[model samples]
Target chain A: MRRRRLVAGLLLGLLLGSSQAFACASCGSGGDDPLILYPNEVDKIYVGVARATAFKNVDADGRFSTSGGPTVKDTLTLAYGHGFSPRAFVTGTLPWLRNSRQEATQTSLGDPSLAARYALVMASMAEPLIPQVQMLVGYKQSMTHSIHDSADLKTELDVFGTGFSEAKLGVDIWFGQLDWLAGAAFNLIKPLPHTYDGLRYEPGLASRSTLTAGYVFSTACKTTFGANLLARGSLRGDGVVQADSEQLNHSAFLTQDWLISPVESWRLSLSRQAAFGANKNTARSDGVSLAYLRSW
Target chain B: MQYLLRLSLCVFLCQACSTHSKADAPAVMPASTEGVASKNGTFFLKMDWTTGPKSAATSAATLSFYDANHHQAISVDSVAVVPWMTTMGHGTAMKDQKIVPVAGQVGHFTIDGIYLIMGGPWDIRVTATVNGSVDTATVAVTAP
Candidate 1:
């Protein structure tokens, strides 16, 4: 009798706890919502785990290396709605790893972001072409503590600064079973005056554009395969002069997904980036992951 | 005495009436083989069931395949069922029901050859046991 009562109480508590956490009264956006990094794409919710490793070399001989060295990151993304409803839903990516690189003297947890996306145009059934437009805005705050004894390297590098704010505008087009999506994003690093000679220094902003093609082969099995090409470039600046300055940045990635079950999936992805023009550098990374998802 | 006699007659008549109704009633429809399709050298066995009005009581269906020459059966452990609604535009629900290793009263099973790596003529058996009543059917499929 006692054990039965205890079990019942525990089950009741769990039920109530989840209901409270996932339920919202007025539909005001909450933290539990899915995060959207890509804009104007398919109408599907993705909840899965992913781990990625990035390797980068500033100079050919490894003068400066920004390899996160097998840093594990998981993502939860949600995309919903058929066509142009002003209200498209999104929110949820929290980075759990502290990014460390050989170039940086000290290491700490990198900035994570929270963002929301809204669709501008909806797909129409009459027309064969379905073009979707959307925007995403996110902010990442830096929380790394300085390792330098004094504010000595403050002017040299913007250490212990408030990180970056980003915005992306994108469009997605669908033709039959194939989906094509492209987007451009801008990242602005906030000026840090306290660390940089009390002179607010704004690092060159980073800009990126992406093109993705995906196909739904078996709708019943919910299996999808796609390839994505991402091009990232840094805006050139007139003031900064370092040993090796970056002028162009480019990267491409390919991804495949198998829906093992409705609530579970396995994914594989690979990417390579090359830096050229005024800047000469190259990097490559590959990763595979499996995740289980449950929705209320 | 007359009242007792009428009550006995009513009981006998009820038994006789139920016997005929039971005879006319449908025998639990046996499970059937619908289609066998192959993709990338692996065969997919599709099974259909006549799930009378009682959907909950129907536990689960099993598919078993046996080798022709050896007469030995090998169970395909990774059988999955994807539920699709006939309603247009309705999203399909896919579920994975891997066979649990357990002993059962009915040893017979249903098997499809599409999931086999090397395919040829194979004996297929399907069993749908519900509430102690076991209904089974078998078919042979040639995989190319």
Candidate 2:
């Protein structure tokens, strides 16, 4: 048993130490910022730095184009939340992202998102293993036109935000009786009003949906170690640069979480993802992120 | 040890499901005043201005091409745009007109910096080669 534990630890450790960037057009290097998406639970706070390396751009051909080199991104996030009642809670994050696309780099405050969640349906005595379902409703605003955003940006990787405002809704499920959880989410985003150099434009997305699953690991110190999978993308939307309605890149992400026990609030996570299967927008990428959290 | 095995199984199964997404055939973009026109029964062309067709002063337009069966042509080696006034008999004279692909948006190329020099009945000659197939088409732009 101890031998099996050592081998598994080594494999997951090896995975946590590397990177990839699977991206789409709207949020590739710049505007399509897939930077920070995690928040601690109610009444807790988390602050961390995250870095992403992106390269091998997917061209319109649906193939990886060699024209541009890898871009790297660093993000800082402050996460907070509160429980108003037994059934209601709110969680949010404000972030800043620095994007580097080859030789050019730009730093800007990223679009912030706020989510209000409610325990919609509780697990019943008849089916305790089914778990309770919670619903989350949220909004995200694009910060691309902020003062820190550069008008002369070179590539999508340099965009700190998508320049679009989005409405998000989703469900969260916790399998308290079991060892795993599953759920889904949806978002509708629209380009915020933007005008530059006497030109006006609006960003748009048909919609985006994400499906998620996570498994829990039990440790002697009460430490938590596990892996999470999230598959997400914009289903239909026009990039800020295009007049035609287009599909953004679709991506699947796998994240590993490790929390130190006795101090369970102290946590670290590593993630990797790939983007593919797009029209108008061609993207093939692999990316990894590492982050630490402080929770109360 | 049991937890480790479970974690390994989860990773193995999830990795198998994370393949790059694929979509259907090329979708038709919104039309410009100059709509889609078929050339030689096997290819189709659409003229659109990134700044809207009315922004003739900007001359930032996208020319999109697809096959007869509606498969979008992508990753072409080169795209050349020749701006000629059918009546005036001269190119834009602006030698730096750029015909480049619109990044991420497949089958679309942008034509920028085409100063018409004069607002007249102009023919924009577009020639593109994708996977050894050369496609050329001409469209008329009424300069603003």
Candidate 3:
């Protein structure tokens, strides 16, 4: 009886933690952002810096083509170890994304996120089909920013706070020169008041699925190119469907690295993606970017 | 080493030529106000090609519609291409294609029997073979 109670308590704790982990409210479609979906099977501490420029026509219907502005975004990330391990070191990434539509309205600010990654299953060396799996949990806070009063005209115009708190579960497989990665994650976004003033809002759930392939160019250098198709569905609010949409975000990227005496290495990468097939007020952003990564 | 060099040279040349061909192709003109129509509403699809030394005396083409999601809707297979000539010796050919509703017409090409569920952005992917040169054009359409 005691053993049963202990098992029940542990299972309950895991459920609560997982629920909290996957809750993130923000766009899941990739645009100019670096692949947050990391590669599988490599063990090392990596630090990367990147910037993205996005031009979006937020109103998918072309009704308000000029309503939303172009956005310039930047991000930095640090990760440690690889595969599924009991504990892994991780930190860093504060994104600053800014939007400027018509000259009359514009806004910008920093989105700060901190998190840790833990591996749940280590791929067996003997079994070729099994994949390495891991769970990532993190918290992100969007710094407040000043916006033009004119931007307050619509709820969609003013995006505030670091959008959502997120929990992620991912799996990766490495076979020969090709590395395949697949993951599913859910984000529970906290509700915020509509910018239109006095309008109550309910943040809905956002989910994503990703697949990536990477190829090794040399012993120390590798380049990866892959496409990730994401779907963001079911936005219910005020007893009605407010913002529900879907988009296919696909990208290709290449990374090069040079080992600096074994302990440390420097890496550079470039990537591009487009948001095609979107419904509702889905924002379409596409751009090319470069990144610098260093390992200690 | 000589054979390897020749193979590499051939690959490089093909890549360069492919890029050039795409760049040289005429851009698809956006449908004018006189031509735009509501989604699912009937609209005439017109295709024109200029005859050249590479132009085939006899050729065939296909017109396919993809939804706003870029998924193919109606694939009108084997649209007969009738040659129409311009007065200035600049050979021109045109075709008025029709959309026929049928099962197994929507979604990706592989899925067995799915039709276009609804309206959105639809892309018309045209594949035409003239003379010996085959070309494809992806045109955008919004279904009301």
Q: Which candidate is the best by DockQ?
A: 2
Tens digits of per-residue lDDT for model 2, A1-296:
99999998866433221101101111111112222122222364556677766544343334443322226878887766676764666667788888776576777787788776666665443564665566666778666653114343224344466455777555555443334434444445443545543445443434555555545454311122222222223222223343222334566565454545322323333433335345333334455444454334
Query: Number of the top candidate by TM-score?
Result: 2
**For candidate 1, what is the DockQ?**
0.00
Model 2 chain A lDDT-worst window of ten: A19-28
| Cα-lDDT of candidate 3 | 0.37
Determine the TM-score of chain B of model 1: 0.28
Model 2 off-target regions past 4 Å? A1-42, A59-61, A66-70, A102-104, A123-127, A146-150, A155-158, A174-176, A187-205, A219-244, A261-263, A266-282, B1-144
**DockQ: the better of candidates 2 and 3:** 2
- Give one digit per residue, the lDDT tens place, for model 3 in A113-194: 5555554544443553554454555555545432212234222234433233444333322232123223333332232323
**lDDT order of candidates, best first?**
2, 3, 1
Better of 1 and 3 by lDDT: 3
Q: After superposition, how far is residue B125 of candidate 3 from its true place, in Å?
A: 39
Tell me the interface RMSD of every candidate, in Å.
28.7, 15.9, 22.0
- Higher-lDDT candidate among 1 and 2? 2
- Per-model TM values vs. the true structure: 0.40, 0.51, 0.45
lDDT score, candidate 2: 0.49
